[model samples]
Target: MASSSSLLSEEQFLCPICLDVFTRPVSTPCGHNFCMSCITSYWDNASFSQCPVCKEQFQRRPDLKVNTFISELASQLVSLQTSYCDHSRVLVLFCRDDNTLLCDVCSSSCHARHNVVPVQRAYERMKDELENTEAKVQQMIQERFHKVQSMTESVKQTAERQADGFVSDMQREIKELQRTAVKLRELKQTTDQLRFLQSYSSTSLLPHTMDLSTVSANKHLEMQHFGKSLRKSASQLRVSLDEMNTEISRFSGGTAESDAATLRYMQQYEVNIVLDPDSAHPMLCLSNDGKQVRYNMGAGMWAGQFLNPNMFTSHLAVLGRRGFSSGRFYFEVCTGQKTEWCVGVATASIQRRGPLVRSSCCGLWAIWFLIDKFETFICPGVPVHMGKVGRVGVFVDYDKGEISFYDVENATPIYSFTECSFTEELFPYFNPCDNEFGSNLEPLTIVPVCHVE
Candidate 1:
């Protein structure tokens, strides 16, 4: 057995297709052997059928059969080589930098200057590190899972509480009505007795009719008030729930989880934005969905609705449907490969007619693409040199008096405004500047937040 093993080297049984021991070994017409699965897979990807080892091409696909003798020899060689590293070199050291096994010869040749440790020592260290990482990852997953469970449970509890409140209120109203009905029955009996006494005594004993106004007046008012209050409270709660759901969707899974921290942080103040057609310039065309705006050359002649005084007479601009006077808000806009456009927030009272300044001093805190360059539209506009930005995110903290812009695609900061006092409500401002020779005609699309997976 020793002599046989010494004669059979690991190279003899190694299949060129797999670079490992042959399995279900098959012999080709070229007299070369390979693992059946490996050779088949290789040919599937290759344009022509050929022997991998001899490079001999076959005009017709060659028939292959298992080489039972070579297969048995390979099995025995695999068992014998287990104790020998790579079937020839014995692993005595571990190269820490490369995280690989090394024989004495390999250590001297390849890992000459690397930090080499005993194989057992490196194995123990790596095993310990892997265990710690696994534990930490498990703990993090549990924490997040529990957080989600808790939130779901909280929602259930809130719904239960609201339902109980509604039931109790309804019960109270029913009890009040029951008491009123009893009083009504008692009044009817008293009236019947008085009428009988009056007919017998031949004298008037009761007013023309009983007044029900006193009994029903307060009851009607109470019910109306309860309905209004309950509806208002329910609406507020629904709004809060919807906001939470929006935040949850922003970082659902996959690549979004990789960016969860940032996306979740930003989603706290995410606002649903729509373009306000009333504020659009006459030459600007607003899409039917009200989420897109573009400059139209022929739109200037459509005079039917352009006569409105509030319409932008000269400047190509539009304001968002909603305005923010307090707290924080964020929205994103897509320039859609358009090079010339303007986007940011503007005070509600900015000048909209004739020759107007587009600067912070003029109530506009914005960034614009002017002459093929991006720049902040503050006084003495600061030039911003950046690559093509398909989507731009704008965040505003009204109370803090801060406005910041971001390149959404690259997750990079573009510019910011700070320390200025905001006296009025701010509206999302958009200007798909005039279509310069039809080159800038693409619509500025208001893009929904894209959550990557």
Candidate 2:
């Protein structure tokens, strides 16, 4: 008899539409399990409703309900998959020395006497640490929210005071104008011409009358002062709000509970990226649809290839046709079994004629994966430790100044470049890397996003 974990495979739990593990799994009338969001999104973008697997058409869209049984099974499978070792045995121990999970075989052979402990014990300790960190983050967020609320109240109070002062001044001016009009009327109705002349010439009555032009100028100056104060207060409030928002985004970006959820959220910003042949290196070959690119070892001998000014003359790299200057956009590249590759976004003004600097300062932000190591292309490349990533997902929040890469297969984040100031449009960048004696001859293919709702 085989164990339950042995009997179950990840592929069985995968949704046919998204080609990923079932999320909110739902069963079709045709007896197929698809991600509820995936199928719904499909029907939403299609002309007719049909079972994607069986191609069976329905007169009306069938209502979808979460398949609880399949959902549980898929959840169990994911847990099992994550806990399994390379030898296909369930991990039961944690090696403190190596900081790795270990199956029975691994414990006895490689990680022997390595400060090993029960997996549960390690999990409990780590869970406590994570909970503490989460509490701290929540406290920080609440504090910022409170600060913003306080600032808002202060701004409101100041605005009210200014408005009240203006109203009071207007009221005083109106009373003075009324009193002056009465005095003029009384002088006009006087029976004695001498008294009328004396009243008209009297400096008290003459000076009591308001200068209309002077009043207008005074009111205008007051309004201008109020306007400036209001604008300054608004500016301060905006800056504070922006800071709070940035903090929130940073906290959320790192603490996302589920990689699947993160990937799904990012998929909403997916863009159709195609390679630009004109910007391709002379030795590089692009597919007809401009969705795939690979290094052609013999292409250097071909003299007929046109080299555009924007073409990369030294590096074995290419850029996407479209450049993004604002908002968020995401694209995925299938590296397949390639041993070496690089993918990310580059500033439109990056130097292309010489050896690429491959760093943020030089306008290139990318992750480079070699045979057994993964790292970013910063000045001193930082190593990334995710294992065996096949498909790479690149997500950019242009306005937030963030560029993140994900291991699409495992739905795990690889690396992120944050707080970057982008001054120009950013183009999707790719480096197939050198063929390296034919070991890395595989083409880098840009695949369509299987959006998960």
Candidate 3:
């Protein structure tokens, strides 16, 4: 009987309900053993009395009496498991310094000078510490969860408000179009030519003429803007969740896999950016594919070049062909070894003639790098300090009124412009600042985004 008991696994002495060594073990009518308190609590919480392991139902709750034999076996198992050391000596103390259970012989010899405590005392202290840590972690999780939920609700409310406004505006425009249609029909049916001409001449068609192309474009733009905003909100939620996940992983001794998730999220909004030749200054030359632009060595050679109204005449800069009025967009530029360069987003309507102010108030949101100094184009140029970077990333959330720059190579943020009010279409702007005797001759090249897996 002793040998048979020795062969029993620890699992055999564990209660199914609590998954711990059975306390006051009780045998149910179904022949299953469980701790008396565990089974009682389980039944009390459940609608019906049933065996947790076997799922067997009982018509009436059975009176639970401790099974003496099983209770003794469980107690003995627990005692046998924790009462001895590897050398088969009784464990009576714990070495606080080494954080290990120790037998009488080992405690007096190996742990003689170490801080020691009774095994029971150490167990109680450690258990309390663990419980406190777990409680703190649980509280943190709850707090973050509430924050995420609040942010999600806020985004939903903002989107709803914007959607309502968009719908109202569209409805108003539809009503005006309907009224214009009725008037046109009435004018077409006029009996007298003079009356018809007079009605047509008196009524202006500029506001009433509904251009299908323009309507389709506006609708597409609006939907795209709305969709991008939703996507941005979702991304923000994902970032919050990722941060929570990282914290949980830290507590659980796991690796954080979300380090690059934000950069990858931004990459998802990468746009196909190309330089606009029409908007390029005469001193700047664009590549055939429009993916690159550089300051021309022969700056004054293009004397007879057709000057475009949108061209940057004074600054050696160029604007991207594709413009964004709403929604999020991201693009990367290779500023490899360039001593002087500027890259960012600017309003399409920014002054192109004469010397232009390179600042937010002047319709520009850009970062300028000269030698080792970096500054953002804000009136007085706020300095940005960061490591030397080879590639630069520009991200614009038009509706959110934010433009952020990142060091693409290091996947780190360099600077950001937030709470900006942009009312016009924004174009990606680049200035390969003057060549400076070939010191800054490298072209600014737009590169395709490569997302992290």
Candidate 1 structure quality by residue, lDDT tens digits, 13-88: 8888678888778899889989876887787788999889889999966655467799879867765564345537
Per-model root-mean-square deviation over C-alphas: 30.3, 28.4, 31.7
For each candidate in turn, the TM-score is 0.43, 0.50, 0.44
How would you order the candidates by lDDT, starting with the best?
2, 3, 1
- Model 1: what TM-score? 0.43
Instruction: Tell me which residue pairs clash in candidate 1.
Output: 255-453
- Return the lDDT, model 3, position 208: 37
Better of 2 and 3 by TM-score: 2
lDDT against the true structure, each candidate = 0.64, 0.69, 0.67
Clashing residue pairs in candidate 2 (N, C-alpha, C atoms within 3 angstroms): none
Clashing residue pairs for model 3: none
Candidates 1 and 2, the one with greater lDDT: 2
Candidate 2 lDDT over residue span 1-453, tens digit each: 998877888889988988999988988888988986699789878999999988999997776667878888987787676667789887778776766778889999997768888777765554454345444434433443343334333432334456444334433443443334334433333333222322343234322322333422233332324444544544544454454444433323343334555676677789999889888998888999999998887775344554468888888889999999999999999887788888888988888887976555888998888775688887445567634567888999899888888877556678888778888999999999886734787899999875432
Count of clashes in candidate 2: 0
lDDT digits (tens) for residues 133-206 of candidate 3: 44543443344334334433343233444544443443344344333433343333333322232244322532
Clashes of 1: 1
